[model samples]
Target: MRTDSPRLSRPATFVRAFAIACALFFLFPRHAHSQIHPTVSFEVASIRPVAGGESGGEGGTRSQIETTADGLTMRNIDLSEMIEWAYKLQHYQLSGPNSLAGSRYDLRAKSGDHVAESTLRLMLQDLLATRFKLQLHREQKKTSVYELVIAKGGPRLPKDKSATIPPSYPKETFPRVVDGGFVFQNVSLGDFAQQLTEIRTIDLPVIDRTGIPGVYDITLKSAASALLDPSGPSILTLIQEQLGLKLVSAQDLIEVVVVDRFEPPSAN
Candidate 1:
């Protein structure tokens, strides 16, 4: 009854089936953990305005967050700072009432479960949404940006001999401004890029293009503020000459923070 076809032997049939199964498994692998972050909220929280207008105010955002099994303490900050920390957004992006820039508050909260800084930031966003009655939307706006790229000389960074994780420093490690240059010891390229974004000279946020990985020391000679000298080389230029990195002009679609509504925070 068989015409032009030959039936596969049982061993051949099993091998073919096994090969197909392996291919499918490799093609679509499943992750044990979810990649998307969850919406987090604190169990109980308090917010209060700081006293003494002329006395003092924390100039910048708190770089640290203390989180315990059931409690969190973040101090010397305003609602605006909280919003910035929560969204990982720059202060300039915020658009709302002028009062937001003037107010400062201290926040203490307890969460149902232990949370990491990343999760806490998400929770803070929820807090802003619920407590502050914050409403906002993101719109892509064309903005001038400085794109980081390898210069003509190539990157001069010393390759990190340490393991992937940099050795623990004596104190909380931070990039230091020394003399006419900035020095970052034991820092990842991504973290360095984040630091560059903080500089006011950079109109738009920095986007890391260098694929160099692992912890390394970086030193760049430039002022953090906008370069005033028309004749002098800009920070973008200094980066290339000193650090073997250059910034080229480019147009980027930035997430413009549009604030629809914001109300003053009442004492908690």
Candidate 2:
């Protein structure tokens, strides 16, 4: 007599089903799975409006932003500045309501201790989109820019010795502004070009074309106020003389962010 195979127990049936599902998941393509996952975001976040004229930490301005491996903090910072940080865009590349610079807010966000800075920026972008209802688009436009190139004497940048210092040594501050000058430590040519854009004298976007590799410790002693004084040497002359670098003006198509819509941030 033929007898039907003994019915499997409930636990055995469940085990078989789970094994099949696991096999299917492993067999699926990786890209398909990635499409199902959501973008990384902060674990916790707080955003509040700071009163007008209020100051942040010592020497901090309305646009100050600090980031660590664990999180990031912004005090008395406006949306325009935050957008710049989030998208790694220069001030001239951002086009939005002038009011974006007027509404200041303090933001604190928490993330995994090992999260990278780039990932934090992405999270901040997500925060702005969800919390502030920010909407924007990028378009190319012709703009004036400066290319940073080596002067006739070649580069005179000092090597950053701090790179060899032990980790225990106190870190030296860089890209520092003093009296009428500026100092940059452990900076690459690209970074130096970006920092130059922050100076009032350098009104156009600075692009690095030096083709020089490695970091440097550079100092520019020219007075920023001198930019307004016709008698004083211009920044172009100062850079060429001091750092053996020159800024050449050129017109190019640059990608710019244009704000389509933005609403005041929702309640925390």
Candidate 3:
């Protein structure tokens, strides 16, 4: 049997082993074996557009004035008309802890887009940390409440998919002073001031602006430039323009006093 059988050589066995190894390499390469893959991710949220600020809008209050000389007098007066001009001052500084907080952003791949969201976010985060001294945090509080979800529940968008976006206002129309008031058009600052002064100084048959002197309402009622910080402008005008804040009549209320006892007239 030994003389009849043909035996396999070491070189042949070596060659066979090499061929098997090559076949395995072709079927499952190093990359596949290690589970390497290109994955898509998403950001937690998106940046919304800026909006908000003042709108020099409408509405006012009414006051009754009884003329000493005449029996009765009735007139509808615009409060803003009483003022000549107004000035405002404000203070803004990035000093608080949250003011310099850091944010995290995840990266995502668009169907047709090449750039990744994560890449952009990382770059922005770095810039904020190094240049702006932004702080990074991760206890849920630092993150935005909203979530960034995909449109079609996939990494890529469909052929003609659309996304619904929300509106944003950087500065919102807020009432600087909580009062009912309106804006007077076509009036110069100096002229208005002079008129106000005249009404106060002359005291010529004007409404009694005593005790609670009539507070005037004035507003800028428009968007402000970046250069326009809080304090330089007149408080009156600045309030209108910056906050849409108007002057409203203060609520009339009487206070009650609790006295233990009223001692009658002491010994005369």
Candidate number achieving the greatest lDDT relative to the actual structure: 2
Higher-TM-score candidate of 1 and 2: 2
- Please give, for residues 1-268, the per-residue lDDT of candidate 1 as tens digits: 8688889999999999999999988886655234554556888898766564321224443333345566566555666657766787755556667667577665788888766667777788888888888998887778776677788868887777457542322111235776756776656666676667666566666666788776777777655332556566777777777778777778887776777887776456
lDDT for each of the candidates? 0.67, 0.78, 0.26
Q: Looking at model 3, which ten-residue stretch has the lowest summed lDDT?
A: 82-91
Tens-place lDDT per residue, model 2, 58-80, is 33443456776578887777898
In angstroms, how far off is 220's CA in candidate 2? 1.7
**All candidates: TM-score:** 0.62, 0.76, 0.18
Candidate 1 segments exceeding 4 Å error: 1-39, 51-73, 90-93, 158-191, 213-233
Best by TM-score: 2
**Model 3 TM:** 0.18
For candidate 3, give the lDDT of residue 156. Answer: 26
Q: Give the Cα-based TM-score of candidate 2 against the true structure.
A: 0.76
For every candidate structure, what is the RMSD over all alpha carbons to the true structure, in angstroms? Answer: 9.4, 6.8, 28.3
Q: Which of 1 and 3 is ahead in lDDT? A: 1
